[model samples]
Target: MSRFLPLTIRFADGGSMVVSSIADAKKALNGVWKDKEAPDYLAATRLVDDAVAGTCRPAVAFAAFKKAAAQQGLLKPADPSPALTMLDDLWSRKGKGPPG
Candidate 1:
């Protein structure tokens, strides 16, 4: 098998896609300059590379991927994380009673 594995992301609509490498991710970011003039581009590339290399958290890289995909109109708005949703629910009821 090829040593390089593609990074995959699944959407709530049952749709999914893969990014094969830093170059692929950069291509998805339309209008991104391919040189040092674009620090965001470089940073994102490094993040994806590190994640694929197992040096960074997959969640972190996936978050970056999601942002790029959304910008490219390939992804829908992301729902809040379960933990954040639970926290919001708790705060909304803080002045009332314990959660039942």
Candidate 2:
């Protein structure tokens, strides 16, 4: 399957992993995760599996996997993209009249 936007997960032992596809998420959920029955974990498992089997969009599965990682305290916040940061700077200065 095609790749989704990458999601980084931080391990308690200070290692980090990036998951960018439904297959990667499936492997992480089924092989690496210890708690097999958490609600978010189950949901992500189903979504990722479904994505692999062509039952849902890869984006939906990837998003679910990211949410599960966040719920489990394994999600790593992405670094701000330079282009997005510049846009944010411009937006923050909005409604402030012309530049001096």
Candidate 3:
């Protein structure tokens, strides 16, 4: 079974959508890039995949992906998704002194 969460992704156009899995996030990001070509598409996808797979920090990976997309003119300036923010926060606290 797939783990589903109420995640919200905000778009560059001031719009947003809710998605569950990494696949859904990829699909949404791809859909946004449909009209335009993203620079280093594979890299962007890989970053997202790695983030979702817990292989890398989500915020860092997502920031890199967004930068690539924007450089390619595929996306505009926007804030990271709420889910990404939360994941990043949690990841940052992973190796803290101890659980409170």
Candidate 4:
């Protein structure tokens, strides 16, 4: 009933980071915060906002997400897409395949 998420983090100051999900990492890096110091999420959100505003580069924000994923040690390795399951079922054709 539970799922595991892979994530990572990267820091500009060479610090460490942690997160639970890709969305969580993104939010941690980029979401707003009341504290001016800006936690990882807030900082990331700011970077993404600047990129969206055309004030910063897209790579900057993208790297932030990657870094966050790394720091959290949650990055998932390359795996086949879930859609492959459907393809397998279709190919097997227990009922849907061409009639003999």
Candidate 5:
């Protein structure tokens, strides 16, 4: 079985989704990474590294991708976000509702 990393995403307007593995998270981020700088593959790699190493929260991985893209001047800075909001929210909401 594949080892999974739990991750969450919250939109600027308050919508959110949770992904259970790095693979899924990559797919989700790719949807946004295409319009930015540096190949989406590269950004995805860096984001995975940052997430696994804990230098970046799994959710902030997206922000890091945005930052890297902006540094290359291929895209503008993404909006500010709460650090690791996805993971944080997921953990916080655990066991409080009906099973999925």
Candidate 6:
């Protein structure tokens, strides 16, 4: 009955997890984060709990969770879209000489 979307948490060790609920987010936050003193981290903990109880918006918790992850360097940059990748490839070959 959680209203939150799944959130991807990328660890510094190159591992990752998808959290579907505030409970899962809390587990990921604890297991993956080391900066307990970070402002966002603290806020996420509170918001996540409140979200699960329907006392706050799930989006609020989601945003806080993501911010906390980012602050702790536990969030990975999203992969570039295929269209963007294609544009980069086309640009690279536009004026470059082939076979030196």
Q: Who wins the TM-score comparison? A: 2
Candidate 3 local lDDT, 18-96, one digit each (tens)? 6555566566576544334545566667877898888977665556655555564545345678898887788778855
User: If ranked by lDDT, best first, what sequence of candidates would result?
Assistant: 2, 6, 3, 1, 5, 4
Model 4, global lDDT: 0.52
lDDT of 6 by residue, 1-100 (tens): 6566556787756778887677788788767466777888899999988988899998888888888887787876667778988877887789654434
Distance from true location, Cα of 50 in model 3, Å: 1.1
Candidate 4 lDDT at 7 equals 38
How many steric clashes between backbone atoms does each model show?
0, 0, 0, 23, 0, 0
TM-score versus the correct structure, for each prediction: 0.36, 0.70, 0.43, 0.38, 0.29, 0.66
In terms of lDDT, the poorest run of 10 residues in model 3 is 1-10
Lowest lDDT block of 10, candidate 5: 69-78
Better candidate by lDDT, 1 or 3 = 3
**What are the lDDT figures for the candidates, one per model?**
0.55, 0.79, 0.60, 0.52, 0.53, 0.79
Output the lDDT of residue 92, model 3.
76
Candidate number that wins on TM-score, 3 or 6: 6
* Candidate 4 off by > 4 Å: 1-38, 79-100
Model 2 clashing residue pairs (backbone): none
The digit string of per-residue lDDT tens for model 1 on 1-100 reads 3223454544334555555555555444433222333454456667878876889876666567555555444543456778988887887778654458
Model 5 lDDT at residue 14? 44
Model 5 spans > 4 angstroms off: 11-15, 33-35, 38-41, 45-100
Provide the lowest-lDDT 10-residue window in model 2.
91-100
Candidate 6 stretches greater than 4 Å from native: 1-7, 12-14, 82-100
User: Model 5: how far is 51 from its true place, Å?
Assistant: 13
Instruction: Determine the backbone clash count of candidate 6.
Output: 0
| Candidate 1's TM-score | 0.36
TM-score of 3: 0.43
Q: What lDDT score goes with residue 70 in model 4?
A: 47
